[model samples]
Target: MKPVISRSFLDRLFAAQDYDGLVQLSSFFQGTSTCRLEKADYGLPRPFFLIVESLVWFAQADRSGVWTYFEATSAPRQQAMLEALTAGAPAGFAQAYAKGVSGWRDEAGMAGLDRWLSARDDENNRWLWQLARANRAQIDELLS
Candidate 1:
């Protein structure tokens, strides 16, 4: 299936290293559905989908708190969020997320996660963009 967002648009955002834009596009593509998405739904590569979805969830967590993130997030999304954070976010940010998840249903761990995310807000975005740039070959189809 083809993407609703258009490859040219994606290519432009990618070339500009617009991580936030890419993340927003993913949210746009998700529409009103709260369900976890499969790559087949959007036709984006797995890595692209992973990073974008992760950022969306991370941003929500950053703004609302980790407790909220856990409450709304599905099981598959939870795993993908961890994968994206570990793969591209700063070590401490990923560690904080993991630690926070240890007691996700309780406020104890979520408080520290909220603090940690608030302290270093937006820094992880660059790392995710850098990861995409590093994997240019994998996303070359966007360029084509």
Candidate 2:
């Protein structure tokens, strides 16, 4: 089912501009079955993208802390949102996602992921990047 988000909620999200609020908004989607933004038919696509950009900004600002919270609370929703964007949104969304990943890697000094990020000639890198971006918990679990 598509999650119901109100305009006020969107306003609150936009106004928050902090990691705590981002976590709260993301956790709000915890039990959602789907995050098909297009299927949401909410007619507020701009706000949705704004939220995505805001998330990217927050992730860029504090990759380690924000990503830890995201892994713990928002990964599923984020993954689903990316799926929806990949399936239907314009190409810019993917570009935004890539930029977010770039910022995170660069700011966090994640040298280990450089090969994956630098393999721009390989189309598979996109999927790998998406997987890495979405599956931090899985990565940790496997390492453990």
The top-ranked prediction according to TM-score is: 1
lDDT of 2 by residue, 1-144 (tens): 445556565456445534455444444333244334444222223323333433443354344433343334344445545555566444455554444444543535443333332332133323323433354343223222
Against the reference, the lDDT scores of all candidates come to 0.61, 0.40
Model 2: worst 10 consecutive residues (lDDT sum): 40-49
Off by over 4 Å in 1: 4-11, 24-46, 87-89, 140-144
TM-score of 1: 0.67
Tens-place lDDT per residue, model 1, 39-115, is: 32234455566556557556887777778877776665566566656765666766776775566888766777777
Provide the lDDT at 38 for model 1.
58
Candidate 2 residue pairs that clash: none
